[model samples]
Target: MEVFEPFLAGIDNPDHRDRVEEIFNWVKTRFPNLMPKIAWNQPMFTDHDTFIIGFSVAKQHMAVAPEEAGIHRFSEEIVQAGYDHTKELMRIRWDRPMDFALLERMIEFNLLDKQDCSTFWRK
Candidate 1:
């Protein structure tokens, strides 16, 4: 959590900060091997220095960026989970519930799919 304190501090709303922190802590605890860091002003997790997932905050929603492949692979479930998404990221509205199960799958998929990737992003 310390790695993300600076980023969390930037959020103006206490509730928003707590929500984001909860998600971050969940991921960090569930996947202890993932390295936590802030890059490009967003909180992201990487495996073996390769980006596994990332997150950003917006006024109406929190954006989950698990890379293009993660979005593509889970497009259906994403929609079913009550979120909307672009090609690169999914937006979970502030009023919506957190889907930890779906999040777990996305992270697991990325960890396995990118295990052999040699770049920060998929090539």
Candidate 2:
């Protein structure tokens, strides 16, 4: 498992560190090819220069911020699914064993779309 050492270093609390670690591990498992790094002082996943998604720990909750089009494409579905869309991001309130299934789906969809875009450009 690749660790975002800088990101882990930013976490001030042991519990928050554990939660962030869990999130990173989950994402790594789902997308083994994803390049993980610390960007804008947050944990960011990417494919080369193309930004994929990011995760950050705030004082009260952990936040997941997907790229703009990624969030826009899923806005309606997210609302329909009863998840709040705020500031072009889906905010998942942090709790132990966080419900990351929804996040996994969103990231998978976005990555697919990104690949489709690249394919279209190549063609």
Tell me the TM-score of each prediction against the true structure. Answer: 0.98, 0.77
In model 1, which runs have C-alpha deviations exceeding 4 angstroms? none
The weakest ten consecutive residues by lDDT in model 1 span 1-10
Task: Indicate the worst ten consecutive residues by lDDT in candidate 2.
Answer: 114-123
**lDDT score for residue 114 of model 1:** 96
In angstroms, give how far residue 1 of model 2 lies from its true place. 6.0
Residue 86, model 1: lDDT of 99
Candidate whose lDDT is highest: 1
Q: Judged by lDDT against the true structure, how good is candidate 2?
A: 0.70
- Per-residue CA lDDT of candidate 2, range 40-94, in tens? 7767887645667887777867777776666787777666655566755766555
Highest-scoring model, TM-score: 1
Candidate 1 per-residue C-alpha lDDT over 1-123 given as tens digits, one digit per residue, 9 for 90 to 100 = 699999999999899999999999999999999999888988999999899999999999999999999999999999999999999999999999999999999999999999998899998
Q: List the residue pairs that clash in candidate 1.
A: none
